[model samples]
Target: MLAKRINGALRHVPAWPLYIVAVVPPVWLLWQGLTGGLGVEPIKALEHELGELALQLLIAGLCITPLRRFAGVNLLRYRRAVGLIAFFYVVLHLLVWLVLDVQILSQIWADIIKRPYITVGMAAFVLLIPLAATSNNASIRKLGGKRWRQLHKLVYAAALLGGVHFLMLVKGFQIEPLIYLAIIVGLLALRLPLATGARQRA
Candidate 1:
């Protein structure tokens, strides 16, 4: 089968390369900012790009299970790396916003309280902290497989809030953020057992 062939090819592909490749983007973005490539508002552009990349990674992570179950394309091996990189991007985005954009701690706190999108984004970031902290064999053994799976389910909520945060932050009827939110909702819907059962037929 094609999936078997793909899986075989993927077997030789190590996860470590993913980490190395993922590092390139942020480094490139930083270089761009320094070189006047990210435009006048370099910090804001950096933050926005990182946040969007994080959202895209979240979407890709959500697709992994569905792809394996429905299409027989097993990428379970790289899921952890993808998830960790996504969390890293999320942290980078927050740092750009906090350290570069809003240096004042009090103002940052006030913005988190006053801006609905920032609140939602911050909530998503909070949800990701534990997941990022425990993305390893040690944490899996410490928490056990079942409990760890339960804890990681928080990714769904984080992903949803990320989409919503994007939608809320953009003014007017922006199609891009709307598409992101719709894709997130659709991916979440695919996780329902009923959806699986229906796909399997009556």
Candidate 2:
């Protein structure tokens, strides 16, 4: 089967290399922004680019389980790397908004409170903090497997908020964000039966 072949090939691929490869996109994006390749509004373009990458990575993280359950492709080992990279992009997105886009320190909190999209984005970012902090093996051992799994479930909420944040932040009715939201929702739906099965087993 194709999946078996792919899985067989994946066995030789180390997850660590993904971390090294992940550095390329942000570096390229920053280079483009600096070179004015991002267009007239370079800062805004860079901010949006980082934010979109973050959302894409979040959606990728959500896809891992469904891909394994339905498609017979195991990415369990890469999930942590996927998640941490997503969180990395999320932090980069927030920093670009803070340091480059909005330099005013006082307005950061004000924007979070006043702007609906920013509020949603901040909420999603905050939820990821604990998950990112505990993505390590030591944290897993310390927290216990069950508790660690529970804590990581926060990604679902964060993913939902991330989709909504993108949807709301866009200037008008945009198909891209809507597509992203739909994919996120569909991925979440795929996990429902798995959760139910686990509950039944318990």
Candidate 3:
């Protein structure tokens, strides 16, 4: 009943408002970073925050389908905005690493090639490119729904890579990264049709 009410209310809500609100956090983070509020390692702090936000948004976007299917909470209207915001943060995170953390072009390329985490992160970002680019009605009409969905399925790969990247980037046995990895794995598992098949067989 509560889900129905929320879903009904959401139908009237515009996605543009969400986009406007979403821009605030990154702007605030940038201000804080510039004003020395991020402490001694401001660049690293800013990069970590942006990367984490991106991952969280990606996870939230992934949750939409599951929420509608399992809990009857429809949020299809905002999924595009959530995905675009996730990509925006991802781009910002990459920029901060490239411009602030590793200013040298050769060193940046070397890190991407030499570091495993950086390699995975770069791969995830690359996968997001097509999805972000084609997120429009015109692209949908041009490519057709089936092809568009297939292309967007790359999101699962990107999400998995993102989880691994986060896990590997943190030093030692950190519980936070492990938790994020576990959440990503759980969400992916929920999307599998195996459970339904097994239940039917039983």
Candidate 4:
């Protein structure tokens, strides 16, 4: 029964073309920016693009469980890649701020300490580093499944921090950040003890 279940899940997941779908948006954004068609402030455009990518990846990471359980696609295999992409764009977003806006390490550090948004964003990025580093089959085997799962739970917190950072960075409340916050909330809700307990008994 277990073997058949796993096979059924595998059969439901679409082919590898789905990976390309994930890569296309960033590529198109870069192409648009390079062609001088993004917007008046290209740096701002780049920053927003990278930030959006980070948020999208966070949402995609959260969707894995629902896709697996609801659609029976077992999309957990893509979660690590989605998480690493989140970290990658987060690094780019930080670099844009450091290089284009702040221009000095001392100033950047000062802003992180003084500005709540910067602090939260920095905290999220910092948490992502270890998760990204250890996101591999080999690392999972080394850490054992239980410890690995516990450590990776930090993603939920990191996603929250990312949402808060974006919310505070905006001049006022906006739809984009609100959407991200809602998605994060929903995803985290799905991971609550109640749902997990049900899954365990299933």
Over the full model, what C-alpha lDDT does candidate 4 score relative to the true structure? 0.82
Q: What tens digits encode model 3's per-residue C-alpha lDDT throughout 72-185?
A: 999988999999999999999999999999999999999999999999999999999999999999999999998998899899999999999999988788999889889988
Tens digit per residue, CA lDDT, model 2, 120-176: 999999999999999999999999999998899999999999999999978867899
Q: How far is candidate 2 from the true structure (C-alpha RMSD, Å)?
A: 1.6
- Which stretches in model 3 have alpha-carbon errors above 4 Å? 196-202
Order the numbered candidates by lDDT, best leading: 1, 3, 2, 4
For candidate 1, lDDT tens digit of each residue in 56-173? 9999999998888889999999999999999999999999999999999999999999999999999999999999999999999999998999999999999999999999988788
Candidate number with the higher lDDT (1 or 2): 1
Judged by lDDT against the true structure, how good is candidate 2?
Answer: 0.91
TM-score per candidate, in order? 0.96, 0.95, 0.95, 0.84
Tell me the spans in candidate 1 whose CA falls farther than 4 Å from its real position. Answer: 198-202
RMSD after Cα superposition, model 4:
3.8
lDDT of 1: 0.95
Q: Which candidate gets the maximum lDDT versus the true structure?
A: 1
Per-residue error for 63 in candidate 4, Å, reads 0.7
Residue 86, model 4: lDDT of 80
Clashes of each: 0, 0, 0, 0
| Candidate 4: residue 52 lDDT (0-100) | 79
lDDT of 1 at 15: 91
C-alpha displacement of 190 in model 3, angstroms?
0.9
lDDT values for all models:
0.95, 0.91, 0.92, 0.82
